[model samples]
Target: MFQQFRYFKPIITISLIMLISGLIISCGSTSSIPIPATPTKEVEVAVVPPPTPTTPAVPTSVPAILAPDDSCVNCHSDEVQLLLTSATEEVEVELSEGEG
Candidate 1:
């Protein structure tokens, strides 16, 4: 009989442990101490006026040209133009080849 129920021992132990834990968790202390409410005094606060907003200085005009010493203008201007030209040529060749 013990040999036949040996496999069920761990399951039964775990179930019993879970059942006791659930009962212990459900039987928590319900009694709470009553807290006395503190009396609040009326506080006098000085009202402050909102500060006036000042207008930000607007730029009269934006310069059309970038600064001459700008590195991006120097480095990318020619490379970007070359890339655009090559891409345009590729599209033109593809169009011509398709037509022919």
Candidate 2:
């Protein structure tokens, strides 16, 4: 029994050491190799190009009337109103010489 115990002790110690080493190696980072302290160099800023003159700026004297919506309701306001109230609905207001 003593002889068996002596022979098995060294084998158990060696097996435990191998298991721990294998576990540590497997758990370590697969992507990177760890290197000691080194400072990185700074990059210089690049100069931007100035804007070139092309088209003239539009005058504010001109009354810029922007169209209302994305749809045709901007130009046809009367048609939109008529469509909203069914086909039979009548509008009594009389239009002036140039108006609809």
Candidate 3:
């Protein structure tokens, strides 16, 4: 038993020394390697021209359009009537008529 322990003691000490040296080398300061510069090749991109503009086709059939009427206020007024008079001192705000 004593002879076997004596033989293994040197082997264990060498293994521990190697492991500690590996750890110390791995934990050293990190340095970045410089990369060699190379010339970049020019890349050609394909550009497509826009299509020629053309006059739009006119409507074959006329669409039925809604005619403006004052009767729409009967249900949309929320039962509240707003009176507008020329002599009234309230703020007058009127929407401009559309050309369409």
Candidate 4:
């Protein structure tokens, strides 16, 4: 019984020391650590009114109508110009131009 008491007493003392240290360590950490502040429910939101719809200004001059004969030129002018520019870069061509 005396031998058992000697072994058990050391184990009990170590366990108690460990438990007390753990509690003390936890308390110290909790005090040092920053807890986030709760957010306020009353937020100041800017209530923006929708933009007032303004009428577009009337045209000062009449717009020109597309010529019926030159429908292809009117529609594909940009594409035609791009193709011509690329083609000219590759090969030199002499042009007898009546109109641009």
Which prediction has the highest lDDT against the true structure?
4
lDDT of each: 0.69, 0.72, 0.68, 0.74
Clashing pairs in 2: none
Model 2 C-alpha lDDT per residue in residues 1-98, reported as the tens digit of each score:
99999999999999999999988887795646566668876887775445447655554464456644457665467876767865675878876678
Native-vs-model 3 lDDT?
0.68
Candidate 4 regions exceeding 4 Å error are 31-37, 41-100
Give Cα distance to truth, residue 39, candidate 3, Å.
Answer: 30
Candidate 4 residues 8-96, lDDT tens each? 99899999999999988988896677889888789788965555567555555544674556566554678866676554356668677
Q: By TM-score, how accurate is candidate 2?
A: 0.29
* Ordered list by lDDT, greatest first: 4, 2, 1, 3
lDDT of 1 by residue, 1-100 (tens): 8986898899999999999997777666344535567889889898654454775555556575866566855546698776765644443334454454
Q: What CA RMSD would candidate 1 show?
A: 18.6
Off by over 4 Å in 3: 29-100
